[model samples]
Target: MRARRALLGIGAAVAVTFTLTACTGSAAPNDGAAPSEPASASGPMTCETILRPSFAEQLAELGWSAQQSPFRIGEHELAEGIQCVWGDAEHATDVAQMYGWAPVSPEQTAELQQYLEDNGWLREEDGDVVYLTEDPDVVGYLEEGEYGMTYQFASGWVALADTKESLDLITWRG
Candidate 1:
């Protein structure tokens, strides 16, 4: 009689253990909550994503040097931005034309001058741009571009993005 009772007790314990396991492993309870949505990017897209079409990289592959780099040219910081190879003035003009960056206008030139001044860039002579910092990280220049008057950087260039949101899209994220 004691043996039979012991066997029943063991059976009851086993049943309880199996029930607990089933309850814990079931997904129905865990499915009640909605999943959180992934965050969307609001800033500059990665150079990797933009250049893969070869649209942005087309200039470099055409014997014009191009690589993606991120560096500080004075106050501004360039991260994962395209660094088009700089050559002689003729070569720069050819490349800029191909890229649709025509020369900027006089008014635009003033704007660029203001920007440089605001950013602590001092104008130097000899038709060359200069950064006045002891350890200058940026180059300064006045040039023309697709939008007319242009101020060029040693590592990057500023252009009026076609759409209002375009600037938001290209501006630094991190």
Candidate 2:
């Protein structure tokens, strides 16, 4: 009789365990919530390949050089994107900085343009690309397309000036 009770107890425990597990699992992960984008389901699209070489050549022409900074890239934490920086120790500055990802919507672009204009940045339209500049320093360019947009910024008057010139030359070549 005791053996039979022990077997029944074991069976009851197994049944109870499965019941609890099923009850807990009833709360499904995507029960009603919309699907979310995976952080890195796809690889990052980087402009570093296209712009880095141009920046290197431009910096060298302006008596500056591009050296990779040790600091963590994408410090902005803006979004899932690529961030690259080259330091010019001679000027104690970043000679070239670029971050690019999927293109922002037209509305977002307009909003950003308005903010920059308010802050003294002049905008110039170059085909699908928009160039933003300010006196003495500050040169930034935004190019939009089906793939995405790339925004590149260069500081220091001479560096900014030459970098634009280099961009014009390179882009014109193709």
Q: Name the best candidate (by TM-score).
A: 2
lDDT of 1 by residue, 1-174 (tens): 353334334334533544454467531111112115211143343432322123334333444443334433334443433323222253553222111111234654455556667775544332332222211234212112112112332222332222111121122212
List residue ranges in candidate 1 displaced over 4 A: 1-49, 52-54, 71-73, 78-174
User: How close is every model to the real structure, measured as TM-score?
Assistant: 0.24, 0.36
On lDDT, the leading prediction is 2
Predicted candidate 2 versus true structure: per-residue lDDT over 14-122, tens digit per residue: 3354345446763222111212643233333333332323333543555654333221212323343233343345766433332232334466555555665676666
**All models, RMSD in angstroms:** 29.0, 26.6
lDDT (0 to 1) per candidate: 0.31, 0.34
The lDDT, on a scale of 0 to 1, for candidate 2 is: 0.34
